[model samples]
Target: MDANDFVEIDGSYLEGGGQALRNALSLSCILGKPVRVVKIRANRPNPGLSHQHLHGLDLLRDITNADVVGNVLLSTKVEFTPRTILDNTYRVDTRTAASITLIYQMALPVLLFAGRSSRLIVSGGTNVAFAPPVEYMQQVLLPNLKRFGAGFELKVQQYGFYPRGKGTCQLDVQPVAKLNAGQFMDFGRINLVSGVGFCAGRLPVNIAIDMQQTAQREIHRLWPEQECTIETVKHSPEKTRDNGAGILMTANTTGGVVLGASALGKKRIDGHVLGSEASCQLAEYMRKEICVDDYMQDQLIIYMALAVGRSRMRTGRLTKHTRTAIHVAEQMTGVKFDVTVEPGGQTLVTCEGLGQLNKLI
Candidate 1:
């Protein structure tokens, strides 16, 4: 293919982070467009592609039989040319505490149009800093995606933590001809706030229970009438266990709105503080009456561009990450996204979707 056929993207766009690379490549795969990204992660202390980023790129290349250049550590520029989306069992092992959910997010959109069912196995961090935990995917993202007719199953075989990462997860994706546009604007009553406090590093189980108690107390304080419950999950008491601890709290509204907030344990941060902060964050989002959480706003941008008909939804704020996704999608697929702040401060995003059908299906 000629160089003119490629969608040239500046990796140092607004966010200037890994997200720009992920969104650009995902849209390129589905649209059958080659992409050339430059100056990747230019704003971070460690500029250029990290191991985590490279793994995602490699997986995408393999899944689509794409030719990739600069699939290496600390590379600043890369080009990807996808041939076709294929179905197979793919695996990736980061061998570090790299964020696995980030990798999964990068590859999932492209898989939605696979010719047949596919299974992806990834090993790395399940819960880590600067990335959404696996629970968020399970409780929040999957539910919202289901509403759009993009259904999949994720089974976490082992939960890995930072420094000693070894978590494993299986993601099953089935082909869909088209995605139904999203219309998530209703803000109904909340039914319950539930959570799972996890204990890692063979820490005492009470460490998790304490966080649960603190989270519940904070939740009641923020939403006096809201019901709350929590449970604890942990690994066996082995010295070789992955080292980490955290709590993932979620809320479900009568309208089926799912929001998640989480905090990982640290040496300086107390468990009470972690739980309290997570609870407060979730409660704050609930009070806003927004259909989707802040992070989901960015995540939904790609699907909105690809879904049939017009897609509109109310989200917390228009994060720079969301804006980056929107820019990349428009550039890659020639889709338009409308973003405006609502009267009550929430942002309403709308898009005239490409309505691109899955050729495989």
Candidate 2:
């Protein structure tokens, strides 16, 4: 690739986190455009590539057969030039308790574009901080991705929590020629609130049961008209490197809109408090006319921009994550976006997708 042909990205642009690199790498693979990034994660407390970030890049490199430089941990610069897209089952492990869901976020688009069915066995932290939990990926994100016309499935094989990360998940994807644009402007009525409460290792099974009951009690009190169901599961002690517990809540509304919130249990943290906190988060989200939550808002921007039609959604307050994603999308895909700050801290986001089809940009 010629120097002028490569897209130059400032790693410190916008929120300046690993997401900047994640979005850029996924887009580069999709667009088949080379990229040179400088000041990578420059604004983070531990700037540059971490283990999770490196594994994500390496996986992309494997799937795309890309030439990569500066992939070492804590490196501040990198270059990626994708050569081709391959469809095959691949395995990736963070080797520690890094965020596996974050790795999935990067691999999803690449696999979707591989033009053939693909399976991924991802291992790492399933319920780590600063990343969406695996339950959220299975319960919330996968359902919403179906609207984009992409066929994919996620199943958790084990629960991996923070510090000792060894969680595992299987993702199977069917290729599609092009992604259909999805509209999510309507959030009609929330009819069901469902969830999962689970624990691994030495925690008593009753801990999960108590959490589920607490969440059910609160949700029923708040929306008596809505149906609430929670399943409790306990994994064997051998399934995890450490003991952990948590709850994941999903609110499904009309028009295929889904919102999710999750809380991880810690030492000295009460299970009832964790369950109630998750319920409160869901209740607060229900108070707004949102098609998705702030996290989902950021997640959808890339897909919406890649589709061939207009995509519109309503979400909570404008976040730097969303803004950063919008910036990256415009730069990589030539999609135009309109963001309006609505009354009462809500936002309306509209995008005109380029409708890209085929393997070439």
Candidate 3:
């Protein structure tokens, strides 16, 4: 297809961040439509493609055998033309502290429609600043995706942090003929609260243990009947590029909702504060009475737009990231989305999916 035939997406459309680029990539591959994104990441400092963004685009190029232009680092515009989707095992090493979770998001939606199972080995920052930690993907997001009939497994081989990222993780995804539309309208009663406290690279295990205890205590104090399980993780210093500690906590509800919050440990940072902040975030989410948190709402937009039926979700609020994702998905797939503000100031997002097919040749 000629570049003129591709959908033209202005990178400055909404939040003007890397999210628009990532959404364009996934939608292009899924719909077999080429896309040209201009002014990429125009709103961020040092705007244009970074190592992490390039890594994601390169992986998409490899998987779909796509012709990609303007993929060089710090480029402000790019064109992606996907010819085919290949189902195969792939390995990607970001070789820096880039967020592996973002990389996974770039790959997952398109891979599910690849007509065969795909396995991915991605190594980079697992728990880092400005990204969703691996635990959130495993504990919260994956389970919710499973409710919509997506099947995938993630295994962490090592922990990594900012500046010196050496984390390793594996994802195995089974392709689906069509994705089921998700309905997340109710965040029912709280049932279980659990989490993992981890440290690596010269950090003592005691730090993880103490963090876990503090988080558990906070949860217990808030809801005396609520059970919070804390798992302490000790990773080898040799496996990580630098020292780091963090905690990720989740609250699972009877209405099949999962809310997650995390805190990163820093030099001279107080562990108790980290734990308290994590637990408090989870509590705040529960009080909001929405099924999806702010981040998950953005993450689910693409999937909902691609599913087989009308999908509906109630989120705490509409963020610029989520708005940008909706716009990009609509532009690429020609899918229509309806977003409205409810009485309590929460946002309700709904869409009818394109219902694309996945079949092995």
TM-score of 1: 0.97
Q: Which stretches of candidate 3 lie over 4 Å from their true place?
A: 1-3, 237-241
Report the Cα lDDT for candidate 3.
0.87
Error of 1 at 18 (Å): 0.5
Weakest ten-residue segment in model 3 by summed lDDT: 233-242
Candidate 2 worst ten-residue window by lDDT: 352-361
Flag regions of model 1 displaced more than 4 Å: 237-240
On a 0 to 100 scale, what is the lDDT of residue 121 in model 2?
A: 95
Candidate 1 total steric clashes: 0
Say which prediction, candidate 1 or candidate 2, comes out ahead on lDDT: 1
What lDDT does the true structure give each of the candidates? 0.88, 0.86, 0.87
**Distance from true position, residue 343, model 3, in Å?**
1.7
lDDT per residue for candidate 3 within 33-135, as digits (tens), equals 8899999999999899999999999999999999989999999999999988899999999999899999999999888988778999998999888889998
What clash count goes with each model? 0, 2, 0
Ranking of all candidate structures by their lDDT, best first: 1, 3, 2
